[model samples]
Target: MDWTVKAGKLSPEKLRSLIFNRLHRRRSDILLRPGLGEDSAVIDFGDEVCVVSTDPITGASCRLGWLAVHVACNDVAANGAEPVGIQAALLLPEGVQDEFIGQLIDDMDAACAQLGIEILGGHTEVTTQVETPLVVITALGRAPRDRYVTSAGAQPGDIIYVTKGVGLEGTAVLASDHRETLLSLGVEEAVLQRAAGFFDRISVVPEALAAAEAGASAMHDITEGGFCGALWEVSAASGWGCEVMVEAVPVLPETKAICAALQLDPLALISSGSLLITAPPQVSIVEAVARVGAKAYPVGRVAAAAEPVLILPSGERRRLTMSVEDELWRFLAGK
Candidate 1:
């Protein structure tokens, strides 16, 4: 069966077993002792707690440094911690120029400076094995030991909220990489520019900070697997189920147009900057998101259901699923 299809997908139990079976041994010294499955990995440090996460930019070779810092820091912030430092590793193909490295570093430095994060260290080199440049960033952040949030903290009655519209990163990447195609199709240059502006939306620092301040109990950035993927992770990690309203999930006009043209499900596309947060029903998460210059909406609620289900606007209910076949795979395979 096609894993992407809503029907005939693997059951959540099978998927969870498949994930845990591959693990070697679990660590015992974890400081912020939350149950399995949380946003950032928490390690207890004296007087404070550290949240660490790492991510990679796979599709775009340009803006490698900028993408690296933002993507990694976004995860750190989602834990309601202030990002403090970053360490990067750059893998570049052979024959790459020194100027390219210099520019990438400059971009990285500028982005870090904007976020008040220091670039502690990194490794950079050129190699023939790599066909293109790839950057991986590991970011570290800290918060008061008493204030950290984890995916497991989400209660069944809490409301599920998302910051920013869906497909921010996907639309930005598509607009930048397919500028000529968009122009040929008679899309306005202004609209394309706005869509390409999603590159700036590649960070969740503001939304994370706002949500954290508003007393969110759990946070997960929507990245490779989009909103559906995020929902699955949060639910599975918390050992709870959720019911998401498909129409209530926010999707931008540009993203809808691009997805329609590409014949892709916007919910399945990659969105690096978007965040999925769970908070008490009393917290005004939507208002908090607006203060940070991002949009937020209540897409669903945590529930006591046995499994994750998505309620379509048409009144049909279907299971939500994820796959190794993400937007990146689909794009490359189609090309």
Candidate 2:
């Protein structure tokens, strides 16, 4: 069996037992706690609560340090909390250079500074157990006890919004890692540069803050599973169905071109910089995102139906699904 789940590949029950259920370790000393399925892990902290999350960069190592911080911080921000600190673990292959390590740390430090977050202590080592560099970041954030948004908060009539464009992170990674192939395929150097430049757009701080301020009921960062994955997560968590118009989801022209070149589905690619927000249909989510210099669009709405679905521009309705085999898999496999 594959280690990850993908669209049309795994039943919901199987995913619950294998992935979601194992994410938690039961403890008896916690109060005001929600289950493991929310965007962030909530823990009681007196008058306020802390939203914490940790994630590792496993697909690529070129910009491991920078991506580590932003990916983890994005999750914390999705809960409508400002990221305060991050703890990072750096694992490198035995032959890695000291200069490389220094450069990595420098980049991470600069990224943390830009986000106004502190670097709490973490472990670092070069070991034979790894063949490449790996970074894991744990982020800490606080929210007013009453204001935190969870995946479960979306209602039937809530509007579903996405920030920025789809496949931002995936495009960047592909451009960087497969430069030769892309250039040979007539991909313009400028287009490649723009795709690689997506690194700067990885943070979701602005969207999270704006949506929270605009009375968003729930927000989620679209990461490994891309837009399709995010929709599944949000709808599944909220116990509501969603109908997304295939044509309404935004994708950069370069992203679409790259997907066509690679014969991959942009909707199924990873998109860490994109944010999925759910709010009352009457709210001006587009204006809210614009206030932060981010683009937002309504791709769908929560439906009263019990199953998630997607409405294609061709007038076909199909079940919305996510897969663990992201675009990373195909890109890395040279498929």
Candidate 3:
């Protein structure tokens, strides 16, 4: 068989067949192993489950340190656990300044402080293999064995909820990286300013915790593939299906304008901040998110079908599939 490597994540089908199919090593202490939608690995610790997730800041050129902490911590939070600390791996390009490294650490510290996360020991090195700096953070968290949520727990008839909005992280990165392009394209300075500030909304920890306390069946933080891909993941993980209302999914005006300007699909762009959740229809998932100072919308419901579908307001239906490559790559290629 001939194999070709892709730029972003591997295609869902290829990933499962080539990589996930070969996990032969298993330990009794391992509560959870790698899967399509399982964000964090849960390990048995007798009385509690230790949740750990690692992520690297490869997409964003700005806010590398801050994003590293939140992105890794959000994965832990999606498992219904509170992140206690982070181990960061900093790889810097040889010519980077000392002040740049200092600011990066400061940014990481500030973000960790906001979430009460301690910085654990990690390796830092200056290397020439990469032109840009990379920061990878491994987050550690814990919860009761029964309280930890996995992406495979969605049930039929459960309401699907999404917090904040889609393309939040993408919008921030685009605004930061393409401010000049946007300005030349007639986008107002104020709009770019507001879009750049979307970084502040890039953490879903508060809403994930709130949803867990309110009896959420499952939660997956929307990343890489945005909402459509995340919906497919949750469905695949749970062996269920979903009906996502395209109209009900919230989109900010800024996101719409920026995506339109860049010819990107807001729904297919990388979204790291939004949390996709499933809960009983009777449960007030929206209110739970609201209590945490975030907006939530009931975008759809779980169903017994074998695959997920996207429903338009005009009554048209389309099957939702994972993007082989994220829209971010397209945006960058064009730039």
lDDT of each: 0.80, 0.83, 0.88
**Best candidate, TM-score-wise?**
3
Rank the candidate models, highest lDDT first. Answer: 3, 2, 1
Q: Could you tell me the TM-score of candidate 3?
A: 0.96
TM agreement with the true structure for every prediction: 0.89, 0.92, 0.96
Residue runs of model 2 more than 4 Å from their true location after superposition: 1-15, 18-39, 322-324
Order of candidate numbers by TM-score, starting with the best: 3, 2, 1
Query: How do the residues 56-93 of candidate 3 rate in per-residue lDDT, one tens digit apiece?
Result: 88889888788889989999999999889999899999
Across 1-335, the per-residue lDDT of candidate 2 in tens digits comes to 76674433345567578776776766542432434235568777767778898888877666778888999999988988889999999889998998999989998898899899999999998899999898889999988777878888889999999889999989989888887888888888999988999988999998898888788998989887688888888877788888999899999988987888888889878999999999998888889889889999898899898867888989999897533457766677664
Decide which is better by lDDT, 2 or 3: 3
Give the residue spans of candidate 3 off by over 4 A: 1-3
How displaced is residue 212 in candidate 3, in Å? 0.7
Model 3 clashing residue pairs (backbone): none
Using lDDT as the measure, the top candidate is: 3
Error of 1 at 105 (Å): 0.9
lDDT tens digits, residue span 132-232, model 1? 88898999999888777777777888999887787788788888888777777667788778888888878899888888888998888887768877787
CA displacement after TM-score superposition, residue 202 of candidate 1 (Å): 1.8
